[model samples]
Target: MFNKTPFKGTSRTSSGYSYDDDQFASKVFGEIARKDWQDYRNTFMPVHEIFKTAVMSDDLTKQQLDRIPGNIDAQFKQSQAQASAINERMGLSNLNTGRTDISKGLAQVFAENSARTHGKERKMSAIAGANISPQDARVNQ
Candidate 1:
């Protein structure tokens, strides 16, 4: 048995048996499969991150927008109370017109806030879109 030359590469083990072609091929195929899986995961990871960012951004914007009406209402009430106190002190009961001015100011503030929020949403979307590679775009589509 010591005079016999084993096939393929010599074994590193003490058994002295060489690897058969099938065994070698099986190991290579397994390694190739593992590498392919790793590559597939790497390719999709960025796409997943981009998608997560987009979703989070939309959610954050929605939360901000939803809070706006309540905030505006609260601010308007506070301003109205202050205006009412001033009018009371001045003994001007007919000048409840302060409510109209308060409404206008609140409306202006809400409009400005909405514009800024929308602008921020657009910017975040642009950043997400810009980060997509050609490969990522294909994968996304």
Candidate 2:
């Protein structure tokens, strides 16, 4: 004989009755929101405050400012050395022909890169020193 109870619809007495998908989903989302807010308060707030203070002071040290350019120059030097070595191994002393010179091309690229990096640095410094009204400062508020 067929079991009529198994064919019946879901019932409170069933073992799966305690599980409510909507309630479980809501509870999971609530916990996730709570954790996200806690992380923002505990982890992000301190770093943001420090950066804000630094920007408000508008006093970046020389070492910090030169760090990017110094690193870039060092990398360029290393690349030039490698290129020179390769040129020597290939029996081409300068890698320059009638039309183009590798060294000159590399120098131009370096100049362009340095110009871009310095321009960005100047822009960041200007933003730090610029003043903004309260209405424009907090767009979300």
Candidate 3:
């Protein structure tokens, strides 16, 4: 008689007969998918931190400009110059533009990771299908 075993690791299915190849494949794929996601997140962290720094610097500059005692025209000119310098250093027109660029980059990373995970899963499924009984494969489909 077949006995169901609880899965201890990340898996597409929660429980299956202990000997099932599909169950093993799902568990292994899940682990690989999780690791890939973590790596992507880690890679994006520096970009996210740089964005945070830019926002903080912009806020600090605005606050300092507010406290300066000068003619409105002079102060406005100084603020514009400082803002332009910051934008240049940040390689963006403004914080919003930087955010848009980062968001697009993150989207691209996500798509690439997803494609990689799907490819691995398809390979595992194919291999498992070849080894499993025909009846089991038909039922899985």
Q: Which candidate is the best by lDDT?
A: 1
Task: Write one digit per residue (lDDT tens) for candidate 1, span 1-141.
Answer: 463336454443222323434366566667789989999789988877776565444454555556666777787778778988998899877456546766766785776587567647565665676553343222212
Worst 10 residues of 2 by lDDT: 132-141
Model 3: clashing residue pairs? Answer: none
Candidate 1 weakest lDDT stretch, 10 residues: 132-141
Indicate the TM-score of model 3.
0.28
Tell me which residue pairs clash in candidate 1: none
Question: Candidate 2 overall Cα lDDT vs. reference?
Answer: 0.56
TM per prediction: 0.42, 0.31, 0.28
Write model 3 residue lDDT over 14-42, tens digit each, in one string: 33423446567677678789989899789
Better of 1 and 3 by lDDT: 1
**Total clashing pairs in model 1:** 0
Candidate 2: stretches off by over 4 Å: 1-51, 60-63, 96-141
In order of listing, the candidates' clash counts read 0, 0, 0
Off by over 4 Å in 3: 1-22, 56-60, 63-141
lDDT of each: 0.61, 0.56, 0.51
Better of 1 and 2 by lDDT: 1
